[model samples]
Target: MSYADFARSIGLGGIAVDDPDKLGDAWGVALAADVPTVLDVRGDPEVPPIPPHATFDQIKSMTQAVLKGDPNAWHLLTEGIKTKARDILPSRR
Candidate 1:
């Protein structure tokens, strides 16, 4: 219920997974406010690394990709941001 409430609070009405029993990721997103991480953790060391603090180009690339004309592009961009944000987020420990 709390997850649903939080998700709704963030303007995600249908994000409530098929089962209402699942946990909401809103808290995690909020928790990741200060973290930096790559979106795909496929153990592919070849993926370029992102610094603890992202550079202007990084931010710009993310924003451009997200705000790009295509919705699919936006999704990809947002996911990338989410990934980077995960690594830098305060581990919540």
Candidate 2:
């Protein structure tokens, strides 16, 4: 199950937010909430972790993974883009 689903199953209020604005909203809700809560910001696992000394080949493989999403892979390029956008932009009111 998804992380958010797992959290909810344990009686914690949770949200899997895909939008920047919704993320802020979820945070607010969690803050006001008396019980445990979770706000899952989806990330692309297919994108290789970028270290300071990453090689060109490593970067290329990471790019390929993003472009060709495998079901076995944990993330998608589109999700990565959306997540990055969310992080960059201010949440909606």
Candidate 3:
């Protein structure tokens, strides 16, 4: 079950947000609730979470996993590369 559903089952307030733009609003609703709240924010599963200071071993392991025929190999690799690139490259904004 989704986190929101799980939270509701446990008697807490739950807010599920699938859109990135609605995250702030979700947080607002969650914070304003009388009961404890769970803000379930959905994001792209293909995009791996890259740490700010990723180690060489970590990159190697992820690459090996992707090369081992993980179902979402292409997306995992591409998104990882993009994430790394953004870290290395200067910000345009």
Candidate 4:
């Protein structure tokens, strides 16, 4: 079951925020709630948690792991590349 479902099962208020843009609103609702609240913020699992400054060895290990037939290899690599690109490239905004 989802976190929201689980929270409701235990008789607490629950809010699920799948969109990043809705995070502030979700927090507002949670904080304003009279009872205890559960804020279930769903995020992309395929996006690897890359450090700000990854070492050459760290990158090499990740690549090797992907090459070894990880189930989510393609998604992980693509998401990682996209995330890195966003950091390296200038923002359109």
Best by lDDT: 3
lDDT of 3 by residue, 33-81 (tens): 9999999887677776778888999889879978898888888888788
> For candidate 4, what is the lDDT?
0.82
Per residue, candidate 2 scores C-alpha lDDT tens digits across 33-93 of 8888888876444543355566668756876765575764445555544555555587664
Assess every candidate by TM-score.
Answer: 0.33, 0.47, 0.57, 0.54
Can you write out model 4's per-residue Cα lDDT over 20-74, one digit (the tens) per residue? 5677789999999998999988868766677879987998898888869888888
Candidate 4 residue 61 Cα shift, in angstroms, is 9.9
Give the candidates in order of lDDT, highest first: 3, 4, 2, 1
Per-candidate clashes, comma-separated? 5, 0, 0, 0
Lowest summed lDDT window (length 10), candidate 3 = 84-93
Candidate 4, which ten residues in sequence have the lowest lDDT sum?
84-93
Q: Which stretches of candidate 2 lie over 4 Å from their true place?
A: 44-93
lDDT of 3: 0.84
- TM-score, candidate 2, is 0.47
- Which candidate should be chosen as best, given TM-score against the real structure? 3
Whole-model lDDT per candidate: 0.49, 0.67, 0.84, 0.82
Better structure of 1 and 3 per TM-score: 3
lDDT of 1 by residue, 1-93 (tens): 445455456664423333212323533554464533222113222223456788888778856755666556655555665657666676554
Which residue pairs of candidate 1 clash? 35-88, 35-89, 36-84, 36-88, 37-84
